[model samples]
Target: MPKNAKKKRTQNYKKQIGQVPGALIYTGAKEGNKLHLHVFDYNNEDYKEGDLDSVEEAFRFKDSETVTWFNLNGLNFVNEIETIGNHYKLHPLILEDIVNTSQRPKIDTYQDYIFIVLKMMYYDDSEKIISEQVSLVLGKNYVLTFQEAEGDVFNSVRQRIKTKKGRIRSEGADYLLYALIDAIVDHYYAIIETMGNKIEDLEDDLFTGLTQEEIAQQIQNLKREVLKIRRAIFPLREIINRLEKNENGLIKEKTTHFFRDVYDHVIQVTETLDIYREMIWSLMDMYMTTISNKMNEVMKVLTIIATIFIPLTFIAGIYGMNFANMPELQYKYGYYIVWIVMIVVLVGMLVYFKRKKWL
Candidate 1:
């Protein structure tokens, strides 16, 4: 994530404090963004799709016999969203959670609908992970999705519904909700696969002793990405588990099986994330160990050089003393003999170190 974007999100979170619980203040950073309203009304026989100019157009679908999918792209417009919420009889807390993009992934059951908050993640053009919050309300005959921005992983689901390629059009709102969530969860595999590749690439060069000093930083960033994905998908596991087992009227008994499949996928994602998290920790430890080993090699070489000089220094110190009875100082070739002796001692130490395999 970009540092600026992260800072902005954190700052926005501060605005939510000391406020009413059900207040419709938008805590997301997408302010001043124009709202995009798209409605997908479909059935087994036919479908109608269009962009609405106002939230009032969505009111007609309140009692729609067919499955209506009201996909609102931007969440900054509090007035428009409020109108939709009021018309649809959504709880105020549900509306608040929908606008609060920082909310966790959760499932809140109501008398008229099932509200689910999910984190939809995908890569931007720069390959940076972008997490968008998607709030869903599944009613008896309609499904409303609120998003922070425009892009999503729901294109395939839309294509399926549009082409009648599968049973989505023939199913009720619960199945639509399932398809939407399944899309997000299925994309999790792609994100996880990307992180796995990163981990493998790092590990490939980690032990070579030729990696750059920034390799540790790379591992740290990778760990953050893994943790981010974990935070997004871990809560989802519990949410899906609860959804699959709930006896709510909005969720059909038959649809529980599909949700069960989704739950399995979430479990796989969380398990992979756990493995990656551990691998990251191991990488950090290995990096530190490598640094320590290199430092020891350096210290060993310096120690050996100092030890070799210790004897020469002792001999030189004894001869450097001012004394009238120094016999070696009176000899003409004494300096040459001392040089030879020092060289021999150095060579002997070198040979001994080599035999000891300490060089």
Candidate 2:
């Protein structure tokens, strides 16, 4: 198509894009709970911090020149979140995406701001399980990050920003965005490391002769964790890749390097996950083989015992029959001879099985 024709089709394209799910839209937070808001504005030499009590308060302290980061810790307050959308002039669709927490990790560049929805995932030490949610919103000099709950992997980045000991204090908001992303990717490393350790422990336990019930339960647990980890990390690789390859003005060229670093981290996470998956599969196979081998040994022993007893039972049955013509019953030495014969038969069967390598 010619350039003029493409220009004429812009409206139609926009309409099509609109029809796609969560395109350039932010979903408002869920209702019935409080959302924590934090604002940090900083430059090379000075900064101001504030705890936002309302959307009005959040907007009142904005600075166009300095990098401002608004961290929304909880998404349960619907009214306040709407106030935020109004204050920031976020598109209604973007607001909708924010409220819909199941959105895929994606990047949408609007006229005024860049909307990014990504899963923030980490393991809670207290709970010992991975948790995740969609985090979103970015603008020229400001970043608005929303999460499902109060705590996340961003604590370390927050500390660095607060102390002004790193480049975060001097860089643009885009770099801060990179820092936020990098911190989350770093957590993926930790999660994978924990999984590696758990897998190792499981392998050792399997080798040490676990019960069938125990092995079955452990396989189930390990596979469940692997699936969870896969869900968290797989699409994240695409997220990082998209960010790195993004040509939008929202992600500056200098920040693409940081995004590239995140991409590498995601790759590492995925590769590690693949290895762990294979390891878990091998462990399951080992468990089955071990159980089958044990059963085979038990059957071999039982068969040998039955074979030795077969002849002894036949001899004893014939002798105990109530036939008056039985020659063995009339002899006094018959009982002693039968005892010797039974002992010899048992010993012979043991030697035979041993020779056949079936014992």
Candidate 3:
């Protein structure tokens, strides 16, 4: 089996293992996902941003009138995560999902707050797609975002909050949640656009005659990237749909429309992904056919050469026999005659093959 197929099998096997529900397990953070926090407290009149050194400091703003957005940059520090969870009265399962990092995009509503998990995707400088889990816990006057890494796709949302550029400053915590979710969904467009360009480049290479190995490797990589994006985006549609149709007062009526817009965008992304996947499958088939045709051409030439040599070999074998009286062997010019005959036969076969268009 292929490497990707083997990886898929291993992942599936891992998923099949049972884990205790609501168990607190800290799956270590990915590289660069250091422990850090960025707290944003804002209202219609005032906005404050702080880089926090401890999770305890974030608890002070939990009951404050100002809407606080605690952006935790990493989940590897189990103590800090547990401290914040205890302070906010988060459900054990909520903390579990936050630390697990492999949970699917989902939303779970509790008595006083809502918990959401999503995957944030972006392309690095090397044009490789990286996905990280982002969990949001929305409370009465606060929204806590847990990220797997220090960097995120939420920089635009952060800028808007700091600059007071949009309704983010004037809105409530739900709007901030919408802004963060919207930022993540919007980043999908950039990734899809990148994949589109890569598919086009691969198509160009395929037609312009890249080596079979190069084209095959590119097609496999492209397919894997597309599958990754699909896994991230497909479930998000249902999550956004649930948010849009939310009857809980946690999501305001006005903000549901924004969630609806995100739902539409997710649908668009999925459709585009399906198209790209089909193109990749077609490209793979085209590559295989091209390689097969090349092999057939090579075999045809070799076959023709072997056919021409068969008769010459037969004539040489007949004269090389140690017969008592071979007439051609007794002739003085027999060797020259045999050479002339062999040359004529070779030329005749070449001419025939040329006329038949099989040369």
Candidate 4:
């Protein structure tokens, strides 16, 4: 076909270049869950929980005295997120990060609030790891949490707040921040534990038999999963360090200790991730070694077969040649003698092989 005969591309492509900063570009799925604002306004005396009818209904909690948690699910609706940001007086960059699901775990301090982003990871029904970006904005008496999807690991924290099970009701918004993050960190244990089980299973599978091709892909997928965990959770250590030394006054002195506890959990998770990383890498080599050993056993049997046949084949070949002056042809019992000699040689070789344990 000539150059002009080719057809133009019909695929729809979204342009990403030359875009202005602070633009609300929802990079998540186009058909995600609708925007839901689950508001929790609670104090030491009373607790209220409900969903907002519209985005405008959440504006009243901006300056309320009670600690309010605005759990906003779904980032696909840029307009709704923009309205909430405008009402809260959040920075343009903060709004940008709210809808940008690719943002890494980080902490940014502002005059009146603190903006933090972290990954929330969990296993689906099929035991596959799924990571969602969660951006948290902590003010004096409110905490705004934005998620890419509806499901999260903060249900236990919500239960605690509703039942007044602990000091969450009496604490400030900083403590609420700690509680939510602690929930996320606590779930990390389950994720790592599941991965540990998988690694152990792979170890056993590789050791018990020659399964190079059988579980090769399994090891690969598990290795990728561990890397995802490392990327999702390791950067949290720096964020916690910032909270400990930050003098923004939004995080109370008592709350800093709680953050430190979460920091300790983060350290443990990262260390375990490091160990998993090494184990996953070694799994590939172990699989290859198993394959090599399998090949060696096969080659050893073949070599023994060839070694036993060499002398027998030589004797037969020598007798098979025809010549008029051959002395064996003139003997009366030459055929019987040759048969006995071959049988004796075969039995002797078999005995020697058995004694050497070559079988």
**Winning model by TM-score:** 1
Candidate 3 per-residue lDDT, tens place, 33-114, comes to 5788889998988889989988888888998999999988777777788889988999888998898877788899887898
TM-scores, each model vs. reference = 0.92, 0.86, 0.90, 0.91
lDDT comparing candidate 4 with the true structure: 0.89
lDDT of each: 0.89, 0.76, 0.86, 0.89
- Clashes by residue pair, model 4: none
- Give candidate 1's total backbone clashes: 0
Span of ten consecutive residues with least summed lDDT in model 2: 7-16
CA lDDT, candidate 3, residue 59: 80
User: What's model 1's lDDT at 184?
Assistant: 98
What does candidate 1's lDDT look like per residue over 1-359, in tens digits? 77456433366777788998898888887776778999999999999999999899989988979999999977888888898999998999999999998888999987778899999998777768999999999899999999988889999999998999989999999999999999999899999898888888888887778567889889888888998898899898788887877766888999999999999999999998999899999988988888899999999999999999999998889889968899999999999998899899999999999999989
In model 3, which range of ten residues has the least summed lDDT? 7-16
Q: lDDT at 334 for candidate 3?
A: 92
Clashing pairs in 1: none
**Looking at candidate 4, what is the lDDT of residue 200?**
94
**Order of candidate numbers by TM-score, starting with the best:** 1, 4, 3, 2
Better of 1 and 3 by lDDT: 1
Order of all candidates by lDDT, from best down to worst? Answer: 1, 4, 3, 2
